[model samples]
Target: MKQLTFLLLVLLLPSCSVEDDSAPLFIEPIYVNNPTFKLKLDIIYVLPNEKYAKSKYNIDESKYLDYLNGCFFNRHDIGIVLGESRTLVNPELYDLKDDRGNESAIFERETKGTCKPDRLNMYIIPRTNTIAIAGLGVTQRTLITDEFLFKTTSPHEIGHSLGLHHLDVDGNIMSRVKPYLRKEFNSEQVSELIQQIITINNR
Candidate 1:
């Protein structure tokens, strides 16, 4: 009887060890090596009129582009080329109200007839000095961002354009809360993004 009891305990220990090994030990941030694909991003500043041309909330196009390029390089070894920039006067887009949920209508209004299919369009609008929605990604590879948001918001929105969604976990590039605090993508996210880029290039 004593021998049988010892055998049963040894069998249970292996099962318990197997269960423990099932869980992952770590989830390291993902990074790509020698990325082959590159994306051209066009930054568009949407001003209400000439009066607000020197508004403090307006983003410096060159500086913002440099910031985005550095951020992407550090994360996934991806390259983002700074494309053309233009200031458009559209009062309707500047003073648009967000009555509808998701703010898709405002994004549509701001990007309609202004986007190019070959490049990504980033529109910085003077909706408010405060960061309301931070950024909105629309079809045609266009993004409408708030003027007062930080440069980190650019990559966050760009991530959305690449088909990545917000993650529930903190300290991730795709987290919904204070994404500016995190700037790195996990291993899985980087892999998915690379695959997405490959698919787009093939198409």
Candidate 2:
């Protein structure tokens, strides 16, 4: 009887061990394939007229697009074609006090009148001093930036559009502070962005 009991216990232990080993561990999904999506650039100017504002900035849209392609999209295998290019003149957006006013609120108000549902909207503004911002995965995805913006600013804002948040580490595209020179996205960020792009495409 004792020997039979010991044999039964031994048999149960192996099954219990196997069950423990088979339990699922919660792990995030990682994507290895490159995902592509459409991106639009909307150069917004708060001035008397669009032509006057263009002269003030003197920005070459095509050249800027090419630079962005090299720095971000092409490197990540994310194909971003130039979409709608428009100039907006909003006194309210321009008049809003930078230090006292809210950038997000200003963006929301301006984009509500001009946002397109199909593509990412990048709003480039020329100002002496203003805050730059980006909407994270919102339907009215928008980026509000100034003429003096760093080269990495656009890509960083676009990363936010793809649902990426700021990282505390330096030399990362998603760093919280400025002087962001790093243009590379980490694997996890890429995977998460890919997932977001997939969901957006599916919809």
Per-residue accuracy of model 2 over 88-197 as CA lDDT, tens digit each:
77756554445334655566667686865556666665543343232212343545445433356566566776677665344556654333345466776777766766
Please give, for residues 1-203, the per-residue lDDT of candidate 1 as tens digits. 64334321111000000011122223233345444666667777777788765353556666665566555543566666676776667766665444324355666765778876666677776536213455665543444445423444555566677676666354565555444356566777788767765665454
lDDT of 2 at 11: 14
lDDT of model 2 at position 190: 75
- Candidate 1: 10-residue stretch with minimal lDDT: 11-20
Q: In order, how many clashes per candidate?
A: 2, 0
lDDT (0 to 1) per candidate: 0.54, 0.51
- Model 2 global lDDT (CA atoms, 0 to 1): 0.51
